[model samples]
Target: MEQELFTAQDLEELQRRGISLEEATQQVEDIRQGFPYLEILASASLEDGIISNEPSQEERYMSLWERYLERKDASVYKMVPASGAASRMFKMLFSFLDADYSEPRTEAERRFFDELHHFAFYELLNEACLRNHWKSIPKLLAQGDYKAVVETLLLPKGLGYGSKPKGLLLFHRYDKVERTALEEHFVEGALYARDSLGQVHLHFTISPEHQRDFESLVARVKDCYEEHYSVRYLVSFSQQEPATDTLALTPEGGLFRREDGSLLFRPGGHGSLIRNLNALDADIVFIKNIDNVVLDLYKGPTVMYKKYLGGVLVAIRDQVFGYLRQLDKGKVSHSQLEEMSAFMRDAFGIRLPEVLDDESLAPWLREKLNRPIRVCGMVRNEGEPGGGPFVIRETDGSSSLQILESSQINMADEGQRQFFEAGQYFNPVDLVCSLRDWQGKPFDLERYVNPKTAFIAHKSQVGRELLALERPGLWNGAMHDWNTAFVEVPLETFNPVKEVNDLLRPEHQA
Candidate 1:
């Protein structure tokens, strides 16, 4: 059967649902043009399972200690995507402009401002406002409604900041020596890798507009690492043009339409980066938020855990490759097949072994034992951030381990509530994979991705208060059918700088 294309009626229906005629027409055109690459990506699969359990708890600890004694070497890669604007931080600037020193702010207002000042960009704002001589600490409350002033003097040129990328926001404690979030993350990556793994590859994904700043930051990182181990930097950007108007949908189940009649949808989420990641083609990839990095004093345990995690992944990949080669030679015997299937079901955490309904394997790995693949987390001191690990039973009667995202768990469910309270385990910044096999066959991403699960994000708008946006994240939305496993790493490995105050912590200051 052929797939149906959008028809004239579809356009009419879209317009009735709130899309402008122009946007409806454009959507129709885009549908006709088709996204071939996306379609291909949506169709790939990973049938062969990943390697099953390897070292036990005792064995792993002993192995790591032994490896440390031998000075085992590993490479570290850190990817920081610095493309988002600092829109949230703008709220503080507004508060500053609207302050009134004469009457004094109420406790509530003062508390809010203090919290806002904690952002990483606060210092940058202070410096920019100071440089422009925009009234040294003007009495915000006494100022006659600075709304107009803000619009006219600030927003038009990127809020009085450099008007460059938000990643370029400067933080200088003394003299001219300054640092941006970009520099901080790069240094963190370099330090962690050097102290733990002995070598590191730090890459930043930036937009074309910020190329110069990105290059400058790279140079600074190189200089800092000159006395330490080797460090390499790779920079790349999406060729797609930036959107002018923010895409949004209307409240009446209608697409937000412009006077020009263009239909609107929120910019597709970060999962769009999966294509960019595929492009990197590195042997190993470490994905971390641009703002998340540990400072010097706290670098030891974090680097150690990163290497251990990477080492485990490398070892698993080696085992998977070896198994695939065995499977390629003639028909796998019943005993061998049973062992492989058992490993997949028990250790790799695969859930759909019976999907093929091969009678030959039914007697071995039972259906009820099948579960969704997941990475088990073991968190050490410092604890873990983000979501904790939990057993997830899919609708298909199989269950696997998964990381928690506030949006995914049903708050109303008693079982989910219990799991949440129990605090099963922390993610510990480690992952499982079947990306490549022993025979070097690329694991098909489409086959493993769970199309049914997703999360919707609520975003704040300039005029419109809040809007919902849907996008896929790596943990819940990015994984596939390949059996997965989880291992624990030290909690010190996950130092993340979510706010500016975080830089004041002993780790970052070092």
Candidate 2:
């Protein structure tokens, strides 16, 4: 039956992409059956799951993080997930290009032209305008030719920003020059992730087709940042491997084909970066989005919060390791086991099933305490369009704190819907992770993922609709089994440039 579904050429392509037959079959089945909604027990709030540390606790954590950095063997790195094009950021401008009348009709369109000179890329766009149309932006605007300027900014004939990644686009302006989002990361790494050895490390996950452009940009700017900051920069990049791509399927489990009659596959979302992250050789890894950056003038709060999260992770990690070492020696007293369970509750919001008595608790505690640790920085929810923290019911009848996307919930259920809506904080993709085990050896990062949490997206190829399975999100389910903690970070620390006009927000303005 499987042979009848996949032709010889289909099998050959699958082989080339490192996908096993069973894996492909399972993906089809998962897509057909659809993922089950996570059983959310309650929303995470300050009274239960989220942690709001006092100033004294914040200071102690920051100091502990500094001491950890001072260790001679420390290897800290920042991971920025920066793949895909920036076309979404230019959606409004793209519409303007095809509009019947082109004098900034929409509010967003008006804002773009009204604040044209305020954009960091204004000078560059003007230069492109002269080269492309032999007319400056003001000259063209004087003639009521707004489409000309929009064309020059997005089309290949101009700056071609509509096709480029956000990392390479100019994001902020300064006294000396403008900086791309990638350059801002270089500046940020120097501020917080730099080690005592004066080396700042960063890793970017980029698309293979844009690898050369990103490398060239890095080559041209790396030396200047090194000179300015007086710190050496170590950077690396990786593309999502073909093995991580999932096959698209119809709701009935039939394969979806492209216009040319070949099977269609899509990259399995950012969760697939777990493999790239597992390959990294850092003791401490900071995960952040590529567009969530600000100018140097607004970086103090961000720097302070990053250090605080790191300190929190290291402190908890040390205690976890110590308790695991004790459990390893065996003969743990009943009181010691109870203390461990209580600490687990206080530290991670983990609650074991009451049915497990002293005998069962030892092994359970060992299994729970020995996993990886991640400290997630969350901000107060202010009507953002993303997931929030929740205490979800795990398969084993225990409860764990997880950052859940709306798609993972059964929104139709009134109880779950209310719990989700009641959430007061939002995850900002700010994280500090410890990937090593108690003995300093790297854990098998793949073993911790909750494969049942994958998301099936509705997409189109050649105007035909199909469902594409995205692996569990990196922070959402990819790290589901890791010991997770949440810290309330200042909203000032999150300044993501989702749309072109968003850059005009005060957070993005220096």
Which candidate number has the best TM-score? 2
**Residue pairs of candidate 2 with colliding backbone atoms:** none
For residues 91-132, could you state the per-residue lDDT of candidate 1 as single tens digits?
444555566543325553354344534434455545444555
In terms of lDDT, model 1 sits at 0.47
In candidate 1, what residue range of length 10 has the lowest lDDT sum? 36-45
Tens digit of per-residue lDDT, candidate 2, span 1-510: 678878888899899999988898889888988889999888887788888967879889999989988889898999999996899999999998888996888898988999999899999999999998899999999999999998889988889999999999999988879999999999999988889989999999999989999999999999999999999999999999999999999756699987676789899999999999999998899999999998777899999999999999999999999999999999999999989988888778899885788888999999999998999998999888887999988888888999999999999999999999899999999999999998999998999999999989998877778899999999999999999998889898988888999999876776
TM-score of 2: 0.99
Candidate 2 lDDT: 0.91
Off by over 4 Å in 1: 1-77, 89-130, 134-167, 170-178, 188-200, 207-212, 219-228, 239-248, 330-342, 351-386, 426-434, 444-447, 457-469, 480-483
What lDDT score is found at residue 54 in candidate 2?
74
State TM-scores per candidate: 0.67, 0.99
